[model samples]
Target: MTTANFVDRPATAPIGEDLRGRVAFVTGGTRGIGAAISRSLAWQGATVAAGYGSHTAHAEQFRADLAGELQGHAECSVHQGNVGLPDDCRRTINEVIEQHGRLDILINNAGINIDKIVLKMSDDDWMKVLAVNLSGAFFLTQAALKHMVERGSGRIVYVSSLAGEIGNIGQANYASSKSGLFGLTKTVAREAAFQLERAGKLTDTGLGITVNTVTPGYVATEMLASVPEKVIDKVKSSIPLRRLGRPDEIARVVHFLASDASSYITGQVWGVNGGIDM
Candidate 1:
């Protein structure tokens, strides 16, 4: 009996350089977990488009670091956009496609949180969080999906939060937005499969579209700077690992999902939390 082409790879084969020729677009790619993700993917060989919001100086620095100090096997470019706006999402997607000619991976890691209890949350706070975290992901995915569907190959990964799975205090809007990603991931995975099948690209060894979500627990980043030290200590004690997660830790999982090695996995939520959900 002969094995299928896609199944013929050696079990012990190294998959580290699998993304050598791929192109990735990472929103919020200038800082925090997103920056780490950009670095991780680029290190593995993917040319990256690092999307940032209104941080020109920071974005420039990030681009410089990628192009100079952190230079590796990949080329990295930075793009600016307010993900909360649909126009910005579409525009940035176009820019990446034009710059790279093709986009093989889409990392919807751009998100914002407006921390306010249900009663204390104002209309702007709710809408702003939803627009950036949930709506931005949808718009960006919508744009990228069209291109991916036409090419019949793509990987989409949404970075969510543990707060989405288990409610967080003073973060009703933020939690809701992240939770929405679960439904989006599953639906996009199913729809991409169906579309590829219809296009005759869903062959036994060819089709490669996949969509998944990565939910990280509290990580050490600038986002945590505003939290009181006492609260930080308490958060650390509550985690099973008794410490905050590192950005690279989450980025590694994301790098896997963005690689061909993860072709068989999709529509799943990977929790990179320190056993927080468990």
Candidate 2:
């Protein structure tokens, strides 16, 4: 609430190098928006653990390319896990900590969508979406929280969707899962603050454990590869920006939220949707 509270806070590094000496874990980090997020964080000097589900080849390629591009400036390792499984989520977090020694950032970006109207949507479709998108984020965050709280510093960012804010016609399952992230964000933010304070980690300068969400509009990713061109055109026209969002654009917002610059921010849903109305 006041500048005095923020003075003298320790940072991982200077603003530009804020992520130096930090480690981040990104779910679904091998492709699409998730890949962009992993790259952005690593570029800022964070060692990243990128999680993938079934795409072994794609994940390996991403790791190789990112490593080559960074050229030892940063480190990225790929981990395989089904985020929807609670045990897998916990194991992934433990593995990252075991490898990197610490995890300072968590990006819950793994998600899947099965488009179907409510009436036509089967229970499997709805449950699958929620399992991967909503439940997975929760379990991953839960596993990461203890470590982050013990260290007295961390960042958690949920990558949501614009459809969560403004419902889509045939994506009831996907929209529900995405919207669920909003409640999860707010609740976790409060709990993290409370736990930090209880552990004597909270101070006038802030402990820096923060939880937030980033909702992106239609991004030009493989996710849209199957959509008809005409439908894509119509969707773009509906957006005020007259184009689908880019992965990097979403990543930029995520980059900020995961940095020390966002220490004072939490429990908020940031829209990076090219001016699309909520």
For each candidate in turn, the TM-score is 0.92, 0.92
lDDT of 2: 0.88
**TM-score of decoy 2:** 0.92
> Mind giving the per-residue lDDT tens digits that candidate 1 earns over 1-278?
11122121211212246688899999999888898888788877789899999869989888888777444567899999999999999999999999999999999999998898899999999999999999999999999999999998999999999999998899999999999999999999999999999988998787479999999998877767677888888888889998788787888899999988898999999999899788
Looking at model 2, residue 182 earns an lDDT score of: 100
Give the alpha carbon lDDT tens digit for every residue of 83-149 in model 2.
8899999999999999999999999999988888899999999999999999999999999999999
lDDT, each prediction: 0.88, 0.88
Model 2 spans > 4 angstroms off: 1-16
Model 1 ranges with Cα > 4 A deviation:
1-16, 70-72
Please state every model's RMSD to the true fold in angstroms: 8.5, 8.0
